[model samples]
Target: MSPYDDVEQTGMGTHGAKESGMDERATLLDFPGADELMAAGQVGEPSAQALSGALARVGTAAAAEAAGRGTGDVAATPVRRLSARRRVLVGMFTAAAVAAGAVTYANAGAGSAAPTGTGTRGETRAAGAGVFLNDMSTVAASQSATTGKYWKTHTKAGDTYLSQSMDFYVMNDGKAYKKGRRPDWQFGPKNVDWKGLDQLTTDPAKLLQLLRTPAKTNDIAPFDQATALLGDTPASPKLRAGVFKAMAGLKGVRLVGAVKDSTGRGGTALEFQEARSLGRVTVDPKTSAILEYTFTWTSGPSKGKVTHDTILSMGFTDRIG
Candidate 1:
């Protein structure tokens, strides 16, 4: 039998009590009335699968912690020893599993008036944003990709983090070349080289998965990542189409309707409400390219403050200016 079988088969049995000593006995005292609470409808019972999964996760975390400390001797650890730390971890995991079930059950009985996720909350609002984005995807996919050794862009941008609006140019030929910043050719947030970009999938769902991979060095918000691709990168028409399609799925994103960029170019706008600020991106549907992105602080000392970036021009070129 596997290690999880031991957890399934036994509890504080005679064998466990002998190995665990007084600390385990004292910890057990805290849960003396758990069965009574379950019987009185004050607590819900979790599925066996949920409990098993929780135990497996706890075991994995414990093994990882042990390896990190240079112990690397999980196999040598006794299941019955029940150290205070292990007892707490196991209890917390088990409680979390039960709590998940209880919350689901409670929500099921909450009736139609209960609030829904962004996908269903305001159907008209969500539908409008989704339709516009999907239409842009179609337009983008139909466009032929430009060909050149260097991809170049001219942009003016400012954010709460920057002291003033700065006009800049970025040219990339495998490595990035930019003005008014680093002496190094590589600059700005970490992005894949052309070789890495080629590895990215064009399927909307899969593209989002790759962009949101936890191991990526540029681990920021997905919205920011998508806009970055639409901004300065040499993303192909197909890839840009995938990015637009994927963006329709982001939570809390809604239509902001027609808007004009800093350059007075008309575009469709969509905004996402983040925890502390609101982010809005405007796209010029005519060319299926991003025109501007803005953030307005919703809380903290910078409440009501706004910052923006506007794209003047972007395309692949034979030379850098």
Candidate 2:
């Protein structure tokens, strides 16, 4: 019944799609099995019974775009087929729709549908998502370069008790550290080499290919790919714009008017909700840098469970733990 129910099976938990070579066994004291990535706000779906969620997300975006182009009510856009190019673009947006557990295609007609705008605000929300992302892309492209010997990010997740947290400080060599937890070096370090980040391009098409390549996980889920890309700020302004553009293209993504992060930082957000997983990425309007990811599980015992990974700062540093 809930829109977000489709995301449960492919948990945003610690177990990744298929890690490229990351072998770090992170210790989560209270929140067991929650993937550090998910804690950071990443993941997505399944059928008529299984694939509806993923398909809906894809169809919704396509249909909404179509509705906007026509004179009719958007609700009647009739989840239809996209052209070869659009189909391919849709695949890219949804990580080839791999989040449904396997790569599946939306049937176009029966499988997809867009949310009819509830009223003026709904129309505004739908349209605002597109414009907001465009604004972010513009901001990203206009920014200056920020690089150091290491790229650092602060990740935090808390429940009613003992707030869980860690610092991911990765050196240029790709080896990383958890500054908050002693034993600075992670055990059994997985090879986190992503030449893509270093050789990041401003071209959206090329960058999409690089980002979609399975690195952290074998299955290249676009949502995770996007989140991971946000893990470290792109080395260049163009690449940052590319990241923003790539995100704008995802199928079911939508905007929430205004929100404040756990740290009480206010900003705009975009999200994908399927089954049990609710993934949100918030951005600072002024800077265009992704501030953090927030995840919520809306069903089962984990219902109402929430997690957040906030990026205090991310850039190069000379040393690794």
Candidate 3:
């Protein structure tokens, strides 16, 4: 008979334990309880699948018990076969998988993952929203007249390039550059209103503050929003879910990503073959206040595919106190 014949033919005998172990092993082979394996750097898609299957079996047993149809022996079979550590690992993987699926479902117009803890969920959501709004406000306030600069650079033959400097000034009375008084070589037009350096100088710590703000309500900061804004589409539902989950607990003043370098010299601005995704925030590592943050997005289309390395950098300007 086949190796599995005894397993299939028996009820609960000497072969039962062996069969159960084999079943658990097979379940693990398919899903492998990613959380535990990942801790040991062994989790991947295959492990995820196996873990999912194992969880499904456990769930089936629980459901059967709830219906009063499952015997104690039947209910305990899977549990008794798997070790406690393996069970915990499977549980974690199951949670992650469920969360990822929930995100996809929510986005496709299904239920929500917004928790229902003792006002904790609402508080978390509010905190995340507040951080995002504050960061936006800070960035907006900093984009004023005296502190902004217009810089231009060009790359022609792989290694050789040229640079040009320009000054930005905003006039409230609307009379700074008149008809003939405009600069001889205008990058776009005199009407191209731009913020000045004085405004930028008002917030030296803005970048740091924005990067450290919480981005998620229950998990990590929203690295995805920054990535999406920079024009990178996430590759999978899991990735999308992970990113949104992360954003709920970020702490920062302003976070901007996907900056394209412009060369005003030519009519065509050279789009960085790969978009640069970066974040800036203040962070307090000791108290979790997030004194400074500048995590760069290193995965996606722009990584290692660009003609030249595009260094996207952000600096914090001190607030005008």
Candidate 4:
């Protein structure tokens, strides 16, 4: 026989032998009908021979007793024994299947085992840095408060000036407050109630010019300096450094720098180191209005460690009354 056939035969035979022992008593009960035939001597020759063989195998008395009990012990007893062995094998197979399935499920969800250096967070940071630099370059040029007008005009009233306003693009890189807005007004004569400023003259360019020029003590600075220093320009360094120094001493602050182009036409371009975290200030050579200022800063959770970079841009007009 083939090897597989040999194994199957051996397994079945071993199983059958074990079941046979358990069913011996039950088999005895089923022999009575056959026993009566033998006793009566009325059984056919073929039936008698078959009954004799079964009796010899089971023993006659045991079989007769089992049959009298009417328990269906002959055929059913061996089947019950075989079922018990089948249940054990089924249980073993089921447990192995469950273990293999669990292993496969775990491996499927494992993803790549190696660590990825460029994750979503890193990509976001990189994009943000590029955007920041571009914005900084623009702001540095805007905040210098440079003016082109040959004759600039100024007017002052008691603690108030012409209804003018300067708009600045500010970046609060520090994220110091809950909301993006923060308190940034300083009290002085020129501190026109923000609510009261005339709508027509509130141009950032005009207001910026007034702020930079030396003003009376009661006069408020024209432009919001903190918001204007985030630009690119040659003068950006001086303005940025000056503001940093000034901030050290003040609590709440408002500052303004006015510059005019010394030469009639706008020719000179502001210059500065783009990479360093410092301040730069530049002015229009002819108008003498501050044209741009750039401030670089670093702040974070670590003691004195920087967490962010930002620039502010300011603009101005010659219409200040």
For model 4 the TM-score comes to 0.17
Across 1-321, the per-residue lDDT of candidate 1 in tens digits comes to 422222322345677665555554444433312322222233345468766765676677667755664644444555444343454454444344433332111111111112222322212111245555655665576567777665555676321111011223443444433355212111123345554455567898876665556433443566777777777567788888888878766656677666788889877677777688888888875567888889899999999999988887777656545
List candidate 1 segments past 4 Å from native.
1-127, 156-191, 211-219
Give the local distance difference test score of model 1.
Answer: 0.55
True-structure RMSD, every candidate: 17.6, 20.8, 21.9, 40.0
User: TM-score for all predictions?
Assistant: 0.50, 0.47, 0.21, 0.17
Candidate 3 Cα errors over 4 Å, as ranges: 1-12, 16-20, 28-89, 92-321
lDDT of each: 0.55, 0.47, 0.29, 0.28
Candidate 2: where are CA atoms >4 Å away? 1-127, 154-194, 208-220, 299-301, 319-321
lDDT of each residue in 1-321, candidate 2, tens digit only: 332111222233556734411212121111211221122122232346436655665567556655656654333332232223243334323332233333111112111222222223111212245445544665565456755554444445311111112233333334443435212111011222333344545676665565445554344346655665655443467666676776666556667645777778876777777666788888776566777788888898999998878876555444554
* Cα deviation of 305, candidate 3, in Å: 22
Best-matching candidate per lDDT? 1
Q: Tell me how candidate 2 scores on lDDT.
A: 0.47
Tens digit of per-residue lDDT, candidate 4, span 1-321: 211111111235565865655454233223211221122222122345544543343344334534654664434444444344333333222222212221010011111111212223212111111112222222232233443221121211111111222222221342212223222233222433223322213323343344455545633322233223322121233343333222222222211112223222232222222223333344332222344443444333332333222212223334322
User: Model 4, residue 172: displacement in angstroms?
Assistant: 24
- As a TM-score, model 1 comes out at 0.50
Model 3 scores a C-alpha lDDT of 0.29
Clashing pairs in 1: none
What is the TM-score ranking, best to worst? 1, 2, 3, 4
